[model samples]
Target: MPPEKKDLRNAGRGARARTPQFVKNFRGVKNWKEASTWLEWRQIEDIECITPDQAGVARGKMMPSKKFTSNTSLALPSAVFMTTITGSYPEDGNGFSYPEDDGDLKLVPDLSTLSVVPWESDPTAQVICDLVHQDGRSVEFTPRNLLRRVVAAYARRGLKPVVAPEIEFYLVRKNPDPDYPLTPPVGRSGRPIGGGQGYSIAGVNEFDELIDDIYHFSEAQGLEIDTLIHEEGAGQLEINLRHGDPVELADQVFLFKRTIREAALKHDTYATFMAKPIQGQPGSAMHIHQSIIDKKTGRNIFSTEDGSESEAFLHFIGGMQKHMPNALVMMAPYVNSYRRLTQAASAPVNTKWGYDNRTTAFRIPRSDPAARRVENRIPSSDANPYLALAGSLACGLIGLINEEKPDAPVGTTANEDRIDLPRGLLEAVERFEGDTTLRDTLGGGFVSTYAAIKKAEFETFMEVISPWEREFLLLNV
Candidate 1:
């Protein structure tokens, strides 16, 4: 017979933290009352009320569980939206601006996202929050809220968009110095991981302990893992998520990044989502598989009743082809991000799409009619999940509205040195700022604020000189 469940509220008092063998999922709780009950059961001491900032970095306050349950809301400075990834504040003017007073915005906890921090020895729970103005309006510039707005747009049309993200990342040896390059960590065999391990079962087994923890942590948090496989690069792995609502999938991706990093640290290694973490290895990508369903009909809108591809499908592709260039900045948000876009790296250089063609910017995976979808290969793993999904969906929405058709699909490789995307960060920002249609669709305030933040980051990058510059130009000039 199975053991009876304990009345944990009382049984857990002063108990040691739950071991992996007994860890339970707490994501089913839907309100503060429910969250409090779970907290009491777990004897949680701390609660992290976090929200993703512009760079998708976790930002918020952590407080005692007692204080967390007693409070109705929390506040964070509005300037968090204007801050750059380097932790520097950009000056006013140049189309970038922030609240002069830097007033506080309210943080409303997303109870659905409440989950235990599996890595913490002391029992702790973290909840994602949504920011709102003092006037009770949603903060438009925040990454989560921006994605929410795009999802709402789909709802208005009685359609729902679904996305499954295939995120690729690397495990590398701990590098304490910023100047040095990263290398693959030594695996269980006492050897450094080598490249060309694509789909190799032995490659994945190299870090069995860390991978097991990743699975355990994900299960404890109720984050579903569809598949995990070794990719082509040394120490690189790809995790595919089950398909669901766009916003929900984005939330999972947001949490999964933190989860994977925490799991890696437990083994004294680093897991990086950087698009191009190494000089010679292939870059990582967050390939998003997307499709739309009619809310009323309960059918994939991309397919017709007879099972043939519908016009909506072509328009969606058309939308991506027409506007993805302007939207590239959201996917590739950093200077290093552009380094991953080269042809030799197998990253897409143009917006040309194809049927089951890995070289194209968009690839229509072969599937049954109900499961038909397009996979966007542009977004880097380092992209803010919320912004990347919003930018992608926004483009498709515009394409559907305009009723345009995509250019001819390429049978051969599309990365023939024909560069449709911006070559660098500044150029991407310029294109983003100049696109009035996208600006209007994604909210003008968001587009301008995002453009300004990118510009600020770019300027910060210019201040630092690279090793190659000193190596080649020191005596040549």
Candidate 2:
């Protein structure tokens, strides 16, 4: 017979006894402090402190486990956040140079983000943090901080932008081999998904347990997911979060990804947000819907009093078309992301705009004038939400500032339009490097640092020898 399971309710009893009085009095939670086994408990309390570097990468370290029961405060060297802005160190490499190598800076947790770890085996709680200089200034390289700056710019003009993200990802059977093709996970129905099942209710029902857990845990972590649907690819699903503040939505997207992956693992499957995890199938995307409203009037600026198209809406589209090519690095980010932007993949390859059309990079969704908005179909699900939102809002703001005029919207087949967008990661990086408008708007330091990181990642990717080379080139050449 199998051994009986231990009661988890009393697991932390012993550790609670050894915890310091001040530590037990932490205001973050009541249960955590009152629990037993403070020193020997299997439960863990961790702070999910993070800062976004120049490549739109979030990098940070967890606070020591002991710190949780010893003190309420947590801190880390500020230089930890700056090391990745440039290619000074490879993703896996340790050696890197930073201006504050002597550890003059510190990361301070923003208590507002404190939440219990809904996914950890051990009870855990975390708080997102921001990096501060030794002299107490916010770091410019921080992606979240950068986005706040753009949002403030819009606020100065009496406009507030709201965003909702539809994130698509795949559920695949876990395969240890790197070269093997991935197949769908065996669902609760005891069968693997056969092929594309776009919007099929049965496809969603197949993975009901995992999906149900995702909803439960998302709510526990305060992520307001509005809808879940089966997407175009086999075993693919999309989670749509309700539209809200840009920063809050970005945070939800970031955490939602983690929640989905964890739930998948617990249910004996793997979930991936890779832009094109499967070849010859519809690629995953993070379609962002955005609209601006007057802060005072609380009305959408994209529509007129008579529900007609407004000039602000046209200028927003114009700005997106002008800046999208340069902002490709942030939207797509990875080399694999470019693969997802191919023709016929339902992914936009050009910067054309249309009404209720999926072929264009930007589309005006059919909605009430009060709900008027632009949908950015370019960004992959693999992108960093903070940077993507920042790039997009900044571009549209430029258009609103200059009142730029957009060309006539395409009636159909935007793919046939010859409008150019960066064709690959290298081209996108070059475009980003040369563009001064995005640099000045987003920040010069961030642009240069991001360029260095992408350059390094691209060079490393080039060093890999894929199975295709050995299969075709070895015999023919």
Candidate 3:
């Protein structure tokens, strides 16, 4: 639990806070070596004391330019530590990153050529599952099938979900010198390439050519991207995609993340979705705009008469309210991701919702029947989109199936959830184990494997001697 407001206020009274600086000219670098040294800076190596304003700066950024109709922008940074899975530190579950790895990701043979089933099958059915395991597609229990299976369920129920994620990212330019391999890589200091234009203007017009090229590439790849826009962050930008079936949306998000990185490298700049890379600036967020459609009628399920959501929509929100704490770990699966979820400065720290309220974790936009939808505002930029979307879809299904009752919508920015999310990796694992809804919904295999994987991560973190202990507690202890 977060310290009581009084406690947090008192404890922070004498502490100095770190602030991120705004990044202007962001051109990505193809070479990781130039910034490899600083990438392992003192704080990142030893995660202790990494505030929301610090490590949150460099994970990822992706926000599309035209997802919203209003010119208004929210200035809040994402709350970092509150995510259920914010701040990832994988334990080599896949041998892809390491040779001779024993993880299951390597157990199966290459089967990309041998898909277990057509795209329309019950991705979760036992027969397809066996086929996936027989082939390499399900190797290491990759998440593709997890999402495919869920969408299949929705299809059976005469529903199809449309999901689109706001990908927010920064373009970073590097200062490289092979002679000083150990030196920190600096941002573009003095050049036309390093400055930014103001929000929604031709300011970063230098990037127009690059953005156009990206648009073409995305189209070729069958991504759902609909528009692109520059955000308030100096080098920050957003991408919006047309919504589609939830299963398709999840697959696209996975492909989209990898594609962004590859494209940025081709442009010789570093691309990141780190929630908060600079202090005193806005952080990147992955706000998911979602809607459900009746498969048979082709009408929006969340829609009400005259094009607004009815009480059924509120019940869906109720399900999110009931299970958000348990679902957070999957949404922000890394430690650094927690840095974006802090209270104050535009982040939502409470379990609340409102009409078009960007600051709330959940928001409902007023729309006509064709556009009525819900926006899940809790995912951090670094989250695994597959798992995050799955969690949300599952939650909504629960609300409708159980006809859950909901609390009154939260109306304030500062109001905090008393049941704050787990504070550490281990704590999150504990919550996962104890959550009946999640364990039951995601299945025993998923629940068990996920907990085991996360537990291994906690062990890895504990094995290290952190810089904070050396700096402030070594000799004193």
Candidate 4:
């Protein structure tokens, strides 16, 4: 049975009380209750939080900090989360903003997300919050809430989605300078990795201490992580999470990233979830394996009594193909995400479906009929898991509703007959904006807000002077 909330809370409290005095002093907190508490929520491309202490209280409610407003510039709020001004603002700076005032929103904690900060120096606890208006309506811009809505839609149809994410990341030596290339950490062998070491047991053992800490902390926080394997890249590794409800899996993925990074920092290395952190190497991807089951019968909807592919399975893939172009912005949220989608990068660049073919965007892995699923290979490690799962499942739901038919499965190589997907962030955002079906399905407000945020980020990226530009253009052009 699952642990009760009261039991978990008591365990967290016990752990907090045992925190060392020196640790508390370093963290600048007197006790657990007095420690800084943050209400975290997912913004466009990253996570942002507000401390309740800074924002004044109101009738037993915690107000949002001043930086929560939509008009606030990213620079004013430490310039970390890549936040941007809402599109409602005019170019000439003479117009009304959507979130007219700051501190008008409230963060209602989801009690299930309550967890003690296992890696923090001080005894700190955090709860993921849902952004809502003062009157108690959910904010459309909230990614978690959006995912909840999608999950509810599936529940309404008596269908439940099971998702397992395989997240690939890199451990690199700490480099203070931004211009230098990142190198793999010296492992237990006292030597840095040089080239691909795919699925090597020795590779995983090299970082045994760090991986053990990650597993221990994840268990303490109730994250159900599964197998860990060395990936193809020099310093890349993949961690698999056991399949479960989409929302629950999303939450675990979100927290697990933080856990891994913290563990790496403690070990004097840096863990990066960037899709393609190294050039001329295999890129990291968050491949999502998804399957649907009938909530009533608990039967796999993708397979029939005789273990053959069901019509619903075909339609689900068809739906995914139709909506994948529009969903690219959420799946590959960053500008660097495109670098991972290049041809033969081991990342999919089209919506081709196949059986055990890694080259296809959607691959049907070898599994029992009862575990039939489709694996989406487009999403990068940098994607917000909540948004990625929500978009993917929503598209599948659309297909099931309309009984759409998928194209014939490609052979061993999908390189010949596949529709090319969007290759840039701009193209992706434009497709997302233009898709009316997605707008209605994922909400118009979310579509507009997401597009605005990505556009702002892209504009910022365009202004940067790169080494390539300087080296080539200084004398040649």
lDDT of 1: 0.90
For candidate 1, give the lDDT of residue 224.
96
Candidate 3 Cα outliers beyond 4 Å, as residue runs: 1-131, 135-141, 175-198, 306-308, 414-419, 463-477
Compare the candidates by lDDT and give the number of the best one: 1
lDDT of 2 at 342: 79
Misplaced by over 4 Å in model 1 are: 1-25
Q: What would the per-residue lDDT of candidate 1 be over residues 208-286, giving only the tens digit for each residue?
A: 9999999999988889999999999999999999999887898899999999999999999999999999989999999
Q: Ten residues in a row with the worst lDDT in model 2?
A: 1-10
- Candidate 2, pairs of clashing residues: 12-36, 13-36, 13-37, 14-37, 15-37, 15-38, 15-39, 16-36, 16-37, 16-38
lDDT winner, 2 or 3? 2
Tell me each candidate's TM-score: 0.95, 0.86, 0.66, 0.82
Model 4: per-residue Cα lDDT at residue 4: 21
CA lDDT, every prediction?
Answer: 0.90, 0.77, 0.54, 0.74
Q: How well is each residue in 1-477 modelled by candidate 3, as lDDT tens digits?
A: 343222222335352132111111011112323222212211111111111111122222222212111232222222221122324434434221222333222221111111111111222000001113323354222354455555665678888878888777776654354222121112333343322333555644656555655665555444557767777666777777677666456545555665576666666666677776655456677888877788788888777657666666777788777777677777766655566777664556566778777767788777676887778877777766767787777777677667777767655553354435565556766776777876666665555555655665566657667566888997897
How high is the lDDT of residue 251 in model 3? 48
Candidate 2's C-alpha lDDT?
0.77
Instruction: List the RMSD of every prediction in angstroms.
Output: 4.0, 6.6, 19.8, 8.7
Give model 4's clash tally. 0
